[model samples]
Target chain A: MMTAIDQSEHHAALENARREFRDQLIDADLLVPSGIAGLYGRGAVFEDIIDGIDRVVQRAGSAAHGSGIRRLRFPPVFPRDSFEKTDYIASFPNLTGAISTFEGDNKKHRALLGDRDAGLGWDHHLTPAGTMLVSAACHPSYSGLTGTLAQDGTTMDIYGYCFRHEPAIDPARMQAFRMHEFVRVGTPEQAQQHRDSWVPRGLQVLEDLGLSAAPVAANDPFFGRVGKMLAANQLEESLKTELVVRLYDDLDEGTAVVSCNCHRDHFGVTFDIKTEDGEPAHSACVGFGMERIALAMLRTHGLDVARWPARVVAVLEG
Target chain B: MMTAIDQSEHHAALENARREFRDQLIDADLLVPSGIAGLYGRGAVFEDIIDGIDRVVQRAGSAAHGSGIRRLRFPPVFPRDSFEKTDYIASFPNLTGAISTFEGDNKKHRALLGDRDAGLGWDHHLTPAGTMLVSAACHPSYSGLTGTLAQDGTTMDIYGYCFRHEPAIDPARMQAFRMHEFVRVGTPEQAQQHRDSWVPRGLQVLEDLGLSAAPVAANDPFFGRVGKMLAANQLEESLKTELVVRLYDDLDEGTAVVSCNCHRDHFGVTFDIKTEDGEPAHSACVGFGMERIALAMLRTHGLDVARWPARVVAVLEG
Candidate 1:
């Protein structure tokens, strides 16, 4: 158990790290704060880095020995019913954003307008729109496969804007972010093997891009006191592995840019996804937080793209 | 003025046009609906077309003769204060979504979870988070230039995921979409000239992609009865021009896939942006609705990208 002083020291250290990234990003003009914590406008240089990282990751996937992957793209929001079916709110209720709207008649709208003009809030007039911002890229992918899977299983590459309502001063933890994920659904053994192999493959991809990365055991960020126990169970089961890299020269403090997870049958049970053999299909996914990885690259290398390592430049520019 | 019957007829015709596109997209498996109108998960083919459109659009900008353009990227949400400052609520109150969260404590969260478990609504716990989904890509771009401009002025290429709350079954009008925009801040004449040139350039880009496009006078979708007058005034002043393309075989019913607008110091005044000469900087922007353009391409050329025109395919695949 951590003491109060230890906890405070840890908090300060984390703050210092966040400040270092925020200050560098601001100085390089790579980020423009919107006066909102954990949300900022990224500049061209930052976007270019993201684009480069995307290319490298995609290339890595294509080079892998597998059946061609089906690529799917989704908007930031998902159906509220689908979200509920996933039982996500039960685990992480505080981390989701529901998309709501003002569904009032003209008179009520006039009232809303009045509120806006009177410097009062207009949100009171807003009603739930039966949808919510996506909490993960794979949510829709799994929801899309609600029924039986193929006998040989399936592989999909999915990307989308994901949202989590964890607002903080830390640039690494964005409220709204992009996620690039590769998901596979098959027998339990096949799924586990895929995730185990991806742990190293993810690291290799980062290394090929001139980033120093190491895979470490990790767990999902569950919420509440009960969630602490769940996290502990997850770590004990070795359900998640992350590829970590130092954002700065201090190797002791590393950030997880890529994560690989094996969900033994969690999604299959929830979404009624079954293999052709009539059993619940196991699933696994490797997700790369694009913005965090790009930020890590910027933090590791200098802000100048030209000054980046030649191999890294070649991989990105290629 | 349109009669009540004429207005109803117009609405029906628009709905039919939308249905035509949605049906075609569904048949092609390019889209998977998320149980909501105007919201869908895009498949690989759809994503590829979007990618192709982005490349064509970017190339068009780079090939343009001008001073180098600064590129900026912003996330979907913006500071509520900045949004309020823009006074968007005065005109389009019905068409925006705010990013809010559940700020309740752990006990409150437990109660929320109980409500979720009971199948009662849980959204009641959410409160406004002081930020809103961006209504336009240029909102942040203009907000970023809130101070003074250089003598020679500035040109920026901004892109972002934009949102509107107008839910419809029409695939042509998405609730959440991407907008690729070019914004210029300078003297009145300079801004106007830039917008005027982009009108033709936008059409040319579409033509090169084997799409049939025409420029026409247009107006923003202002709300309420008062909004009609505002829209008429806007069109009368020739403030907006759009590149229209037929979403289906019916050429009479065309959609605006790209738009060019001259704000004439509207943003400058609102954001307190001034030129080096001590005058409010006039601003103009040309925005391309990426999904709409890609959909237009698929509609015009057919769903099979491999069979597209050689020139168009080369430009996209290159």
Candidate 2:
């Protein structure tokens, strides 16, 4: 008994079936358009199915965090005072972003080329290039995992290029994407047993890459009116979940492509970290959403990955 | 005889040997800073030598572009009117970047939380997020190679995540980076024989990736005083070259990890792209600079890629 694809008529028929599956993946060239609305350009067989779903999500996140999950990466900009100490602009200040520039000189680059030749807008000669943008690929690995955290707690394997200004037409609501995550941290019973074992190991790695998924109980578009009682206390304590799939067909609300979360101790008290007994560490994470599972494997096997499913292209070319 | 690492005393002894090789790559944990100044973070042995110099640069760009180039990736923001039709903000407006957001509502998000509680800065409630950051990994594949071309004039390969605000201390001057290129557009004698056959096949692919490169004739930091006469007519029409390398030790000037250039028809008269007998097509590219060849393979193999060089780690793990 669940379905609220956002206040009614299946949100404009799930946004006209995600704008006709993003115009048939930009007419089969596998999405390339960059004329704004969510910025893109992937091609090369949609980046060889996002590099075979990024090497089958790094061998299913190193077989669920064993190779001492460390990897890092980052670079979609960060550090504007470690993104304002992750108060995340008070809960997604309309999906934040910042990186502005033109830090002038030469008489302010000749009045920024005379306000780009009198259009009166050289973006007020830009500014705050102390960086920001990355809105979460595990928010720059919780500022390099602040401090302490050993008693069975520690893992990262992050990634990056994330942003959200929510411009949509649902090519998986991109406004710059890619995520990858994994995270973890520690204690609170190993962060709820590593998010209850990645909510059924992320629906068995998105149903071993061929689709059919589930999970649900999610929440976190949280912002405004005390982020609606902190998104109903993060869905009455379930602490976010996601996974979901239904890439469109009969869309009774799915599109999450992996999440998990858990965050109790909210990034170990905003990264003072702790744990191995000194308490406060519990973080979690999961993530994925790499081009929303390569647009849910080009909306459930089609935009030619040489005809998708043969044991899902042998576990994404094994 | 070229030592202008900028100004001279060999520019503060090549920035004190690139600040002691960025403090021995942030003391061997292979750089993960991000407290701004050319942001960092990239561990797992600095991303496995940047994924083994990105698979020996896609097998030296598919053994020099045979598999019909065409990789495309782009997503470090672009399309702000195709970035002002590549005039490149009148030549690198102090290294560009744009993304801004907080598109108000909820009473401008409580006046952006009362300007972050009167520190008075909600970045003027952001705005122009039509995107813009990537400064070139072949600037969004010349707006998808605009129009005509096919008298053997097309290539592309491409790649991305690039930005350049030049806040340095020479960790290869990264202000957000990564590039890969290959490009070529056609007929101005195939863009001057593809930048004169990649200036000696890019110094023999950086001496088969063990570094120690050469090839100079550069020029481009263009901007004022009529961009110093277009950087002295691009070094008297050599139209850019680069390659360079000497990562440090007694640095007599190097570091310009592969460039090449040769935009003979200035991107076919700014993307009107044409060639198969239509004129206007001549372009070129080359690029590379992926994390300045992973900081010259950790300044010539030291950051223990398991004690590097076994034929340059078997051409980067083959």
Candidate 3:
């Protein structure tokens, strides 16, 4: 078993490596610093690579589903009540994004200004807008699809500007990230089939992009004692799988670039959605962390896109 | 010399027209409502049109600036200090969006659950993240480009999912909408020239897309008495212009689909960006409200994409 000192040392080393990679990216103008941790701007080169990765994934999704897949776009902030139904705040309250806006009159505004001048925070004046920033690409999709579905169900290509409150220096762990999710909502068999098929297909997508990747049984970092039980059950049932890549050679396991999950009928029951057979629809989604996958490509191939493999370049640059 | 009753009637009529247009969009399934005012999810058709409009704007930007323009992408949020430098809150306090997240540990989480269970909001448990949701496309671009520039100046294509606190039923005014900005930063001459040229060029771009638009003198709705002075000064200097379109035929004036502003030395000095001459840069940008323009298109044409004129359709469909 690892001792306390040994664990601290390991964490230090891991952080150093992450910092080193971040410095390299900043030096090459691949990333722009925003002064805040986990919040960095994407330079032209970095955005280009992300664009390439997006195209690659879009092509893959289209190839598999054809016109069956439809793109769903949502603004980052969603209705607060919709978020409440998901109970995401219960497990990940620390990472939830709630919008606070100035809702006061002129008198309150003057007091806010006074607080600002006095060097005190005026955050209290900014009341909650009754909306929460989207934490996942598929979260907002459910509220829009609340009624009934067709016989075979629906396939959606949902993209969201996701937010998480974990501020860190790791380039892979951005506070605000983009998640591209291929979600299937329908019968239990269909949901399972979608997740099962994506496990290999997702690994292949990254492999084809010239990254060494593998599928690993995984569970989300659920919070608290009850969360521990949920995670264990989730792992035992193989409800979650992650396609991970070795971002750093020194690391034992890989970082998850893609997460494939079968949520059973949790969302369907909560959102009041039913399948063609009149039962609660089972939902499954394969979410691609667009930036993380691109970061892996940068680490494996090189930061320079022109120097990447010709085959990979063609797929991304298209 | 309209009576108070007349004014109220005008507002009622305008709201009725907005509701009518919204109903049409809903029936067509082009716009997906999130059950909240101003927040929406774009259906496949709506997304396709947005894609088309983006391509059209991109083509216009590229055709004018060539490789001289670079695309800058920022997350939906930025540092609170960075926002303060712009002094935006002083003028538009009610429209600012600040992020709040749960910062408490397990003990606090338990208390939070208690409050939530008691039907009282746990907003008090959440603290400010020191990052505000982006309100403009070009807001975050300044902090990243805080340094000397080339002799000729720099041009950038920036896009942002912007937010404003004002929630409304008018389809043209989305609380969370996109702004596609073609920005130029340099000498005073360069900034003015950029804005002046775009006054006509921007109109043409929209007109080509078959939007019945025209440029009119405009001013931001600044807060209170001081804001009135700012607005007057801005108007006197001709610092702001808007490309407005008639959302409803009964309205006296059109709604702004695009805003062209010359923030001369305002952002440059604020962000500490310098031009080739060692003096502070002057900034100008033509911001196209993507959804508003698309809405204008839908109003001008029809809700059905297939029924739109071929010339107009080609501009957006590409």
Candidate 4:
């Protein structure tokens, strides 16, 4: 298990290592070539990497639109009133960012200071979708699904970038990460069945990829006054557990590559998700910590990526 | 081009198709397993897919950390003040939300309102990460990277789930999507070289993964008054060209799966991303639209993931 002490040391060491590596790459001319569309040296290689990602996404058996999983993508921003209805601010005040309008003196100073090369001033930053974040990939899926979905039982798998405001530097715990989440909605039996099904399979995926993994109980990093209770309940019921393993980084504590959680109707009820039979659906999600997995593979293999096993190369090539 | 009219129609059809596919899977028993942890069903098969992803990540590259890329997971929340500095609210007012302090109407009502459910005259629903959705993955990445990164130029391929408030719903143009962004920071030469190098490599990867892709010019979805000028400048300078191809949902408009952007020094100047060399480092990114590519793969092969080509499977299985 990773403790605060372990995380702190890991963060410092990782930051140092990353800075060094970046310096080396720059010195060696191993970077994006000019003329590549977006910023750095973009070339067919980047496209190839993307294509490789596509193939993996397909093989994951969670094909989009089909693959027996319901897929719904909703607006990233939600109504401010929507969140207020849920009491999010009170529970996690420090972690939240609210978007507010500036119609006073502050707003005027911003206008006058325009194009000072300071970019858009603060006063102009008024938008209704303030503080809202798709903390997890499944939130939007639940919200969108509830909007017009039939009251019948449904299961959905939504994948997207889940963001957080952590100030850490551990590669395993990124501020921004790719989350491949499979969300389900239905009766308790249905939700539990969904979570139960993916556990062993998720393990197998790790094994097949030539990686070692273990399923362990996990908890969200819920901070502040409510965190203790949240943690206690999670441990008590074993509601949250993640698969942990060692990756390439030199961190003392291993990383969590996969988190298979059973939200247990937490979201279904919140979003008014109901089955065709009008029963409030219970929901569960199996989230793949994509970067964690990637780093794990790197550690399992050699540092020289070119020397990676042919089999692994073949998978991306295919 | 993904036009307004065509995009609307295409999205509607895609949604319908998505629903139909989900229904079919349930009827087939192949999908009844639901979650990844479910019993031996499609979820179990996802294990196999994960193996493929592991292989690819290992073969593609290696960082010093270990096998997986060293990830710096940060808190998923940002301060409200930070967003305001980014000018997000004014540019997209309708898409923003705000967290607020609610002063009750009266002593009795205020006291009652303290209990969210009681105040609302109903049970309070579950609230996930509120309005702090990431319009772009780079926003958070930049926030995290700029603060602690060594003055020396550094580069990283950060992956995350990016959300957008798209009123439209084309399968290719999702509201929530995964962006595999390879960002680099360094001198102009280093940045340009990095971008340039990926172009051919990107093409190769796509071909190796068995997808048809081509480079084409693009423009951002800038809306409103200044949006036109921004879009026009981007188009004229070819600032937003992407490598795109036709997806199965619609064979007419070419869908963008990979976008290679050259941010030049925009973010560098804005965030004051100074390189170890003491000069403002230029930056660029190669972004992969993971879902679009997956959708393309489904259309290219067949809806039935099992029937994918042997070669394609081989690469993924690697």
Model 1, range B206-286, lDDT digits (tens) per residue? 888888899999999887787899899999999999999987555355889999999898888888899988899999999
Candidate order by decreasing lDDT:
3, 1, 2, 4
The 0-to-1 C-alpha lDDT of every candidate, in the order given, reads 0.84, 0.81, 0.89, 0.54
Worst 10 residues of 1 chain B by lDDT: B246-255
- Candidate 4 on A196-297: residue-level lDDT in tens? 776776776666555788887777765454566877787788777677786534444457877777777666677776776676667777787665665566
Question: Using DockQ as the measure, what is the rank order of every candidate, best first?
Answer: 3, 1, 2, 4
Tens-digit per-residue lDDT, B1-318, candidate 3: 989999999999989999888878978888888888888888888888888988988988888889878778888988888898788888898788888888887788889989998999889999988789888988888887789988887898888799888888887778899999999999999999999988888888898889888899999999877788999999999999999999899565998999999999999998999998789999999999999988988999988888999998877767
B1-318: candidate 2 lDDT, tens digit per residue: 765754577678778888888888878878877766778888887777777777877787888887887777888877777777777888878888887887776778888788887877778777877778888878777877788877687887877788887788888888888888888888888778888898887777778778888788989898778789988999999989898777776666768988998978886887788887778888888888878888888778777778777998788777
Best by DockQ: 3
Best by lDDT: 3
* DockQ of structure 2: 0.27
* Quality class of the docking in candidate 2, CAPRI style: acceptable
Model 3 residue B231 lDDT score: 97
lDDT of 3: 0.89
Candidate achieving the largest TM-score: 3
True-structure lDDT of candidate 4: 0.54
**What DockQ does each candidate score versus the true complex, computed on alpha carbons?**
0.67, 0.27, 0.78, 0.09
The C-alpha stretches of model 3 lying farther than 4 A from their native spots are: A1-5, B276-278
Give me candidate 4's TM-score against the actual structure. 0.53
When just chain B is superposed on the true chain B, each candidate scores a TM-score of 0.92, 0.37, 0.97, 0.70
